[model samples]
Target chain A: MTAAPTRLACFGGIYSNYLALEAALADVRRRGVDAVYCLGDLGAFGPHPDRVFPLLADHDVVCVQGNYDDSVGNELDDCQCGYVDPQDNHFAQISYDYTLAHTSAEHRAYLRQLPAEIRLEIDSRRVLLCHGSPRRTNEFVWESTASDHFLERLCREADADVVLATHTGIKWQRQLAEGRQFVNVGVLGRPENDGRRNVWYTLVEFGGDQVQVEFVPVEYDFARLAREMADEGLPAEFQETIRTGWWTTCLEILPVKERRRGAF
Target chain B: MAATLPVIDDPRVPQVELASFDQLWFQVAGTLCNLTCHHCFISCSPKNDSFGFLSLDEVQQRLAESVPLGVNEYYFTGGEPFLNPQMVEILIATLEYGPATVLTNATVLKDEWLQRLADADAASRFSLEFRVSIDGFSPETNDPIRGEGTFARALRGIVKLVEYDFLPIITAARSWPEADEARVVGEFTEMLRREGYRRPRLKILPMLHLGAEVERTHGYRPSERITAEMMKGFDRSQLICDHARIVTDRGVCVCPILIEAPDAVLGQSLAEADRPFGLSHGACYTCYQYGAICSNPSAASGGGHAARPT
Candidate 1:
């Protein structure tokens, strides 16, 4: 196994948000990070799906295959976001259709070839990176719902000292037994429904005894993106979420505590 | 639907091995309920004591046992979870362990209990969810199935839950036809909003053909049984028996739906209960048809509607 970089920048689910991706990449470059990684979901819920590919390629962002990536790459019927509600699914379908139609064939091929998971040894600490939980590609590992022991078991089963994932869109970190850690590296595609118009990424640094995890918020041209979405005929709900940082669609999949924290 | 079946080993019966102890359920109220709904799958009523209430000490014991086993979330159900005297305490204690969800009819909820529960949930890192049962959008449609005035009472309880900043998920059995789903859900959402619930969460359940429901409507036919052929390429994780085990006063049962069956009681402890369950019950068919029927829609155990790749 190759030794991973000591300082790494990680983001999850670009969701076709090239503007945010640009800003996040610039911020990480300024921070002098050794490596930058993206945990899949390269497309969905945003306009101009093709715009994100060049930025990722230029920045040398390593990728993992998200459920959306799996669907769009394979030309599947729906984005397997794991939403059971009809309204949520309806909006998800709209996003998926728009994304799949707009994504370039070459980009789709790239997504298809992306690994489902990326493993590296960071300072001899086994680190695993995936779009969702290591067990399932589409699983929603929400903070309030995922118990400590459950996460510990997942870490033990995956044989990783640190597991980084971000399918649920929200960012949370939990310390497990024996100093193991599980972190959801938030999402760059949209705001985290915290009534703030800034999306976030995570910086994981391992050199000392403790593993340092920092959530770095990226302020970008969200108004321009929303206007672009309107021009592209994306749902007003999606734009509203981008502008207000409050999720308007796909609300049912959120666990009770998470939903209660949101304006919707 | 055929009167309860005996636990006989059949070669055709497909057995589902426990995948992970993700969900730990407690039959907190047992079969005793304040109101007797016509379509109750377990036939719970005021006089029905086939099952008994689980005390706080019993629930705490199981919660402790669940930690090492890596139980993801906890669910509390029965005729009505609030019917149990220690329901509030049980939930508060459970919050220390993990996220807790309780299924209730909402007619017997007290403000004091809601206040205390809300405070406990606020302090804990886990979520405390309430799934209120209301059969219809209006009393005219709902009263016939659930007792009279229950629709109004349930609405009031929902409003109280909202006042406590709790987004209660209104779970209604699909008493109406599939065609009317959109209309019924819309009306239900509107009704709750008018009653002071701004953002209403709703979960519609397919009526299980068992217990009181079997008498009200019809039982499962022989054709409804799941065959070994049906298990081919099927996602067994969708079935509750593959991930969940319920702790009843009698013992740890296979799943919540089949507690009435003597064979449902698998063992006394979580360790002993961790075994493959035979999907022989007719209700298992409903579970097979619609996975995660008993779990909250947002729960990890709840099956997604999207078509997963085989």
Candidate 2:
């Protein structure tokens, strides 16, 4: 007997927006996506890591460790984002120094237990699920990075039908050399480079000769999250950035111009 | 009638930046976030300890190792960079060798921290910039994803930056459509102006799929891999990680993003990462696509765009 071709919804970076998560599941049902590949960072920068992680863990998601996940899983003192700064405010420094006093040993153990990368065969193609790059769980891949760098990484470090990544919180999709593909599922927990407070996610469908990656958006209540952060005693600035998408911290690596571009 | 197949694939389409910073990034902060949002890329709650922090000594060692090679920049990111215990010390250390930037959710802005950052920036020959992430204009617009009271708090924080005489660029993710960009910015400006912030600058970023975002939406496609043919005649220079290397406590990683990859570890030095590398991930494709078509075409970004702005 023959089997039906598989359909996949390759998403990543669900930073804890339950409303958006609900919408994504609805999308999967509507699209009849057979499988869902969660690239990693199952929790970070949002209010309900516990709520979200349990839900995702229950699903048949192909999960990997995101840079943030590494921090959470390990109970590392810092996020290890490597954000270069001239002065190093206490917030980031504190984040780096923080320990897992509140979380259970089980959750910390599980995060460490998560794989850096996951590989699956889809449409006769080897799909690699990684938080950053395949070899590194915390690497951040962005559009500004070079091609030969990527080509060399793909050709030399590892090979796959497509490399799915998260972090940088952006939605992007591109085709690479040698019939390979790259998809940035974007951040469902956050906005996709716009000023409005909506979220983004992607849906991918594979056909006999064609493949497609779709970016999906959702709406949720932000006040609840802010209140949660407040209730949790999170930093006021960090809580506020969630609402505004603006960083209170100084990014030493950003272009001088990327500094202070948005007023609100 | 002229036939326009909609250019299913735009031959002359402007490209998108998809390459990973491929460098190994540090988990400067684990799940311990300054703020908790609904749609955090990695649902980082106050208690979520996922990644660990590198010691100042480790960072110093990494810096020394990275200087020999062309690797020149460093970035700090996390639940809250300021939240890290040794953040100030870490920045002081990183400035010795390379310029640095810190990516933060920007809800809390302390006058002392900004003053210190400014002083250090003034003191250092290397550059320092801040990329603040504020999702929307009003509480109604932004609070849904970030959390309750976030809009007011974040705006107040931004206002505080203005008090520090800073016009911090507001980083907003593009949750809205292509059409709403200007109004968004305009509204943002009006709000900031009312808050005493003038000369508003904005950077709208697309969302990334990972962590909490995965639950927020469906993921990618089977066909989204980067093919060998995708690189034909493409300018690989736009991908900065090719020429750049990141120094971490563990060693000199290829780029700041992929610290876990052994190959990315690149010996104990940046000089080692200088060796040629193959574009290995799907993020590379994004680098090519947008690096081809997407530019900060916005008038606010009057200057030519940086390969990666943040």
Candidate 3:
């Protein structure tokens, strides 16, 4: 019997941007994708979670806890992701508080019970859904890790053909030796660092034997969101990132050695 | 085929000094800090003394050996260096070598201590600089992270330094949007000017995720880090401290930041530490891409660019 190819959406870090999420959903609907999976960190950092949550629910997106989502869901005081300098002034703090308040309790509850990992099948091909690293939700797994053994072990344990991840927002896909692939669907609220204003999302088409993931940059008018955040007196910093497609509050996100190393 | 052209790892690879100055930060009080700021790179706090104090004798012993090898200045850092009872003596001995800088939260620079340090700075032949870390200008802004009343106490410390004609360089983390940075720094500069210092050196630092910082936010995303192959065109010379060493109470170590990392210890003496490091961590990129992270001129300093001395 000829196999029916399955297509899926692998994406996360919505950061509460309704415009971007709506655009992404439209794409998913058009593609007639098979499954919708999130990398984690649904909100917290951006200004518009109220709108993004409904979309996730309507789409019945499979999601996980990003560090920000974890802190908010846990009712924790800080964003457990270790991304900010506690000593920051009200400008930054105001932003964090705003993001925290914008997060829906239902979404927080959803995130609270969310699985750190998930496994999927595409016509018999295996796939793993992990936020950052397997088992460790807040860990940062990048190309720099360059460790084959760990990924190899993960694929074996999950009995999967590919791993999908998010948190460090960027589009990347690499093939390990046999048939394993590591892909990060990227974040929707922040710019992709490629100097583009549009955020990133990914759609994967899978056949019985092969899977193809494509980076889709979605453009939207952030004027309403930016103005709304400003009106809400949310962190001006948060408002700025929504408009600029980048973040400036680089506290915990900046590695100490790298901080000292100076970035342009 | 007779002339075997050398591979890219050729002798022609240029070398640049990463940092002649070493941030041999003496976590004098260990992980014990005066304030429990959320994004502390190493996550130090008042009660968390995971690392312990190195007495005057220990510091002096390390310094004695360091000067002979052309080791430059010494820097004293801690949960609060002054928290140490013998911190004065540590400073006294440190100044005799090159110059000394003590990084303080400025939450507790008592009058008696400041008077002594100012006297020593004037007496010393080498340059002595005091760098203070403050997150923002106002209490509403700075206090949230540093605890209430810290900004008030910190300001008094800065005022005292200015009174003594000691232009202390104020450092603040870049915790706001880039568009607001200039205004924020300008306000700091203006505040410092009104407080009696003419030229205020402010440093805008990138946050390092460590210790409590990890709990506050996430650490480096797996995306950030250096690889073996990426080091090909990388200037080996820029990782300066790799060739040098830090003589601590324990022994000589690779670099300041790596003190906590395993295999951080290179050898017993400064000369013995002559070797190259793999630049395995995310922080290595800071050194490789930018020149130095520890030894910037001001707190409001700009982000790094490909700068060569004019």
Candidate 4:
């Protein structure tokens, strides 16, 4: 069995923000990691969706298929982000339409061929990399809603000791039974709902039966991204999230605990 | 003569297998409710004793059983879950296990109960969701359906819930046409905002045409049953029976919506109830059309097309 990389830099939901992606990769390079992986969602909610593809290719970041990737790849009608509120879906549709229209055919093909999940072994512990949950591509798996047993079952069913997922856009970690753990590696696409203008990525390292998980904040030129979004005719709400570090759209999917923390 | 309803044993009716034991619902207060709502699918009323409350011990037993099956969350429902004497204790105990959501009319709630629950929620790692059912935006529109004075009482309950700092998901069964959702939801949000709920979370649901609802309006047409052909290319996980089971005083049923149906009872225990359920009823058609009707917006389970926005 090929041993998993000892130190890995994992990024989630680049969302076409090439600036943040570039910043995150450079940060990862300076800190030094054995490998870099992206947890899908390379497009949506950002400007010029095609720009991030070259960065991923240049950096050799392995990726899984996120719901957005699947939709853009297959030329589907929606982002499949699973927002049930009209306003949320309306904003999601705007973002999806923009991303779909902007993504290159070659990039879409690359997204089309990406695997749903990747499995690795790290010092006798199995690690699973997935976009949302291991089972579904778009499942949110918010911090407040995922029960311990639910995550335990997810890991057990996927035959993984450590499961890393990102689709909810927020980062959280829970230690489960025995030495098992689950981590939402956060996102490089946008700031978490917290009022901070910085995106995040996770660094996971394993040594001597101990797993160290660190969330590293990646700060980029938010004003530049917001300007580009405005230039591209993206929704003001998307630009607002970039500039203000607070989520202005897609608020319906948040559970009470997570929603309570946001400025909204 | 009336038309014969479809039976479960029919081979042509599609069967939905239990995909995962993700949501476990408890008919905590059984069929007894404080007020007789015109649209109640189960015809629950204060005088009805057809079903009885599940004791806290009983709920705990089921909760214990649920853990082994890897149940994700617990939902408490009924005529009104708060009508049960032990509803507060049951919820407090459930917070220890996982996230819990209780669907209530909110009229019978006590400050003490909300206070205890508020404290319990604050301490738990999981969220305790309160799905408060209020059918219409105004009392004139709501009172005729729910009962006289219910709108005011329920509004007070919502204020109390908010006072305790709980962001309750205001669930309203769509009493108006689907096209009016935006206006109605806007009005509802404004009402909640004026009543001191700064940020309101709302979920609009389709009415299940059963029990007293049939008398209120016409029941489901015979043509509304789920045929096997409809199962093709359709996501079965959209149906609650495919992923959830309800624990009642009698036994474990397939889904919360079908608890009153004779065929709804799958088995005596969660383990035994882990069988495929036949979608033979007209209510199954509603479930088929509107997926995840019983779940919170946070718990949507699929990755395909976007759902119809509420």
Order the candidates by TM-score, highest first: 1, 4, 3, 2
Residue A70 of model 4 has an lDDT of: 86
DockQ of each: 0.55, 0.03, 0.01, 0.51
Mind giving the per-residue lDDT tens digits that candidate 1 earns over B11-79?
779999888789999999999999999988888899998889999999999999998898989999998
CA-lDDT, candidates in order: 0.89, 0.57, 0.62, 0.88
lDDT of 2 by residue, B1-310 (tens): 0010011232332332323333334446544687876556546678766445667877776656543322334667666776877777787776665556666666765777788877776666555545577777778878887888988887777777667654566777666776887787678778777878655556666554334544566333334444557756554544545445555445555543333333445656444545544445333444444441112211111111111111
Decreasing lDDT order of the candidates: 1, 4, 3, 2
- Model 1's alpha-carbon lDDT is 0.89
**TM-score to true structure, per model:** 0.98, 0.46, 0.48, 0.97
Task: Tell me each candidate's RMSD, in Å, in order.
Answer: 1.7, 22.6, 19.4, 2.6
DockQ of prediction 4: 0.51
Candidate 3 chain A, run of 10 with poorest lDDT: A255-264
| lDDT tens per residue, model 3, B89-124 | 788777676556677887777778778877886676
Among incorrect, acceptable, medium and high, the docking class of model 4 is medium
Instruction: Give the number of the best model, judged by TM-score.
Output: 1
TM, chain A, every candidate: 0.99, 0.81, 0.83, 0.98
Best-to-worst ranking by DockQ? 1, 4, 2, 3
Worst 10 residues of 4 chain B by lDDT: B301-310
Q: Where is the poorest 10-residue window by lDDT in model 1 chain B?
A: B301-310
Candidate 4 true-interface contact recovery = 0.51
* Docking quality category of candidate 1 according to DockQ thresholds: medium
Put down candidate 3 lDDT per residue, A43-85, tens digits, no spaces: 7555667677778889978786666666677776655442323
